[model samples]
Target: MAGRLVLDGGTVVTMDGVRTEYASGHVVVENGRIAAVGPGPAPAVDGAQVVDVRGCVVTPGLVNTHHHLYQWVTRGLAVDATLFEWLTTLYPVWGCIDEETVGAAATAGLGWLARTGCTTTMDHHYVFPADGGDVLGAEVEAARVVGLRFMLTRGSMDLGRSAGGLPPDHVVEGIDQILGATSEAVDRFHDPSADSMLRVGVAPCSPFSVTTQLLTEAASLARDKGVRLHTHLAETLDEDTFCRERFGCGPVDYMASLGWLGDDVWFGHGVHLDDSAIALMAATGTGVAHCPSSNARLGAGIARLRDLKDAGVPVGLGVDGAASNEASSLLEEARHALLFARARGGPQALTVRDALEVATIGGARVLGWDEQIGSLEVGKQGDVAVWRVDTLAHVDIVDRVAALVLGDRPPLELLLVAGEPVVERDRLVRVDEQQVTDASREAGRRLLVKAGVAG
Candidate 1:
């Protein structure tokens, strides 16, 4: 089981620089890294585990650039609320969450993501109760149970409603506590090695929910520790107005003034950015995690994905939070990205392959993990997702990539991280799916009761 893994006789869609495709190919994984990927018969090796993926399409495992895994239990809440209203309604409920709820929600959310073919994911969990013990650690435990490569953001929100922020005071942490815990998290959990299964990031919620001081300090700390920075930026017009009135500048200008525009930073839901802001992002190599489904669900305008890509900005896809998206399937999120782009422009706006790229390599780039993941090339991590093309949803598929985007969700036959199977035969291999669901449901009920919400 620790030796080479051969995926034989599948259509390999390598999201390499040239966007190569092999009608019939073999992929070899050894020691958690891709050893070979080429056409025709695979080289036989003694004691290698060969998985016959005939009649399937194999692609680099999807990477989810942004998520709020702790919000998994809050799906369908504030269904009719906009961005601000939704946060206002749910802050109290999220504040009621403790270590147990965080673990359950993360387990369920990460399981859902893994089932949907995501290998690497980033979670922007900014909500933490004043007494919530080891919230980030609980999420890491869940990721270990799900066996997904996780980049857990040590997200902090120091400003509260009393201080003109969206969250309540009890949910926001002190700036000192935030910085100290973030430093500890980076030192304890973040692994800079190429094959690390877990990493940490510093995210200070957003400009509206955090102080300028917290943002600057968090960025500095992240840089000092050699980690990455993330937050929500230009997600809505209200945020733009907040920046204009509060900071006397636009979101992009304020960010740059604080040394936030850099290759090590990525922002979520960049829907309202203008031409100059896009140019800044392109120049600084700052990436965007486009949550098209969540944006549409909350009535936020569609992001200018086409414009961002053409500007040389690294663009990726995210399912966002379960509360906003009401779903956590990265593969389905790709379809939403394609449709949203076409709706923004014409039918030629975002191609199917473009959507796939955003879900795969582009996401890896957004997380600054492109060198280790995102493609089926040799020396990259052996993370792959296998979809059955012979399924009923893809019966008449002429173009495999287009079919993947436009067709119904194909059965995810297998998903592997570091050459180890996490999901196989349409089932999660590491954790009991039913147990995760039950625990999450129970914890959600308790949280709603504690928050005084009748469910």
Candidate 2:
């Protein structure tokens, strides 16, 4: 139970049903939920902590729909390779991760995301090494240390190189092992409450990395457990070719045949979808986690973001893994999403507000959490971000939202999840940043040495 808090005199952008914007407003929070939101000063309340955010932009804390937090230790590897080439080169190294390395990497990754104004993030972790002891538990503990809302999708890869999959045989698990572990993980971590700090989902790696039986059974398991489903789909030309050769159809059609499209499902990297695929997704209420930076980094094609938006598809922003997108900043994802959309579809492809929406409400929708945390409403949880727009990097911009989405990344004044401060004055509240960085560097060295890639 958090006490009362008041954020006064900031430009409030409520990404609600009406897209309301308050020029100067006050938001009062009580008992971990929004108590009031309106223009001008807040009503005086005794013993309330007041934060003067006169030059800041107050909005819902950013939601990251997709990520690979364990890849934090593998940043800057295979920099010039395509997706398949990159995966082949890194799988051997990733096969050496343990609970210690994963914990350190997740700490660094979650800390960085909090600094970049992300309040909630979902991690798709599929690489389960044979010797890796409780990797999922390690990351969940890391999230607790960083004090951010986390969703862990127990991702599985059952297809190996022997079976024509992308990953090597050493990194793949058996179907029974994968399903049992996924069920256990959900029972241990998932919280269905409106103000839950942690949740769990079921995710198979991708179309090319898993067998049809695994996909079908995983979907069935997720549905039976009442959890969401996620997987990579249509990410590259190579993926399309592989699916066409192996499954006798495109990636979208193959997944559709296995009953993997619905409001309870979201796919990462829907970059190679055609018009018919887009219509199918829209009709089925499936969502997309658009990772523009990773796609550009790996030379994957640009996703049809404008078309997805126009067709009423749920879409969200993602920074993806640090291995491909080394920056891994959710705020920068908004800028990249805007620039990439325009580069592909001209200047009118996306607006600044549109990018912000995808980062906030749009992402919440993808995670099936919009009713609680996506907007600055009276009854929603108090998950908010205060970006310092009065700084030198953003001071010149007239529109605060544009400054946030188009200009350079501004310092985060504050970030709150469930009314508790996770970041304050550009620093993490619960953990030491320098310590996290040092641990991550050590973890990276240890993993590379274990894999015989470094001495």
Candidate 3:
């Protein structure tokens, strides 16, 4: 077991049930769990490694509920295109990616997420080229190297353009192959322990890219394995149109018919949900991962975040894929969530604390891991993010949460996952960032070249 560590003299925001906060406090961590947290200095421990975070604001480490880590290598392409156009333009390039490229991309993406104060992240990787040897294994290894709590949804797409889907035929897989591989991924990777660092979910890409059989069967498979289910829904108007024309209903109702709405299920985007959809999601305990920046990037309408929250629907923040939202910082997503919510429903829509909650406990709830993570409560995992708010960009902001959500992104002084330091002093502790960046760049070039899109 690792030795005990104490973070002393920081403003502690314990996002517990009652939303506790301490102006000047300390947190004691032992055996990979939070032992204590309260006002003033922590009780003295004989052999504890104490970190003085006097000028910092310590909060629960941010949780990113949705992302496509493989897209790190595919950024800056189809920038001006719509969602459908973008996918069409890049599907071929993504199909050329093998295990090596995926590993590089995942490593780079996870390292960057660490530097940005994320201790837990979920990756939705749907593209699996036939020759892409163990792409899932490669990303799992990347998460291990980066030392973050990871939930990898083995996403699949079996509906090709031949079946009126968005992806090319070559990128789509057979139903039998997808279900078999998804089950294998869950069996091989998912850990159901209270303190598990890794878990796998079953995700059948989206309604537009997957058939009814895959979605229904995937939900059943996830339930059988006692794991979670995830997929894209209501992400764009085009998807709404597709669902209406093809499935004869909106995305939410169609998913409901397949028995996909439950506490164990969470959908990405959800930007086009209406009053009825929101109500149904709330009633079913289904959650939504709100990707504010990505929605704006794709010119997709902003999600009814205020409505969802008011309706008691669990809403979490997500940075989405780097291919759409190039700035993949989870911290920035909190800012965007606040701004977008206010834009849609006036200044009273979302407060700074609300934004922070969405990035932390709300995400934890969406991922169904709030019992173990997402807050600084005693006995929870010691996943904490210490932001240096004493800097020039935030020193004047009296409210720590406001400083974090409203001011410029503060430098992350430290990021801890399960009492282990994943990032310290504003840099990654587990991997070399520069090397990861270079490898990711090379992977991008190799993929484009393989697709004959680059020299």
TM-score of every model versus the real structure: 0.99, 0.99, 0.99
Per-residue lDDT over 1-455 for candidate 3, one digit per residue giving the tens place of the 0 to 100 score: 26699999999999999999999999999999999999998899889999999989999999999999999998999999999999999999898989999999999999999988999999999999988999999999999999999999999999999989999999999999999999999999999899999999998999989999999999999999999999999999999999999989999999999999999999999999999999999999999999999999989989999899999999898999999989999999999999989988999999999999999999999999999999999999999999999999999998988999998989999999999999988989889888888899899999889999899
The 10-residue segment with the lowest total lDDT in model 3: 1-10
Clashes of each: 0, 0, 0
TM-score between candidate 1 and the true structure: 0.99
Error of 2 at 83 (Å): 0.4
Task: Tell me which residue pairs clash in candidate 2.
Answer: none
Estimate, for each residue in 1-455, the C-alpha lDDT of model 1 and write its tens digit. Answer: 45788999988999999999998999999988899999997999667999899888999999999899989998889899889999999998998889999999999999999999999999998887778888889999999989999998999898998999888898899999899989999988998887799999999999989999999999999999999999999999999999999999999999999999999999999999999999999999999999999999998899999999999999999999999987788999999999989998999999999999999999999999999999999999999999988877896898888778889888888999999888998899999888988999998889888999965
Per-residue error at 201 for model 3, in Å? 0.3
The segments of candidate 2 whose C-alpha lies over 4 angstroms from its true place after superposition are none
Relative to the true structure, candidate 2 reaches a TM of 0.99
Residue pairs clashing in model 1 are: none
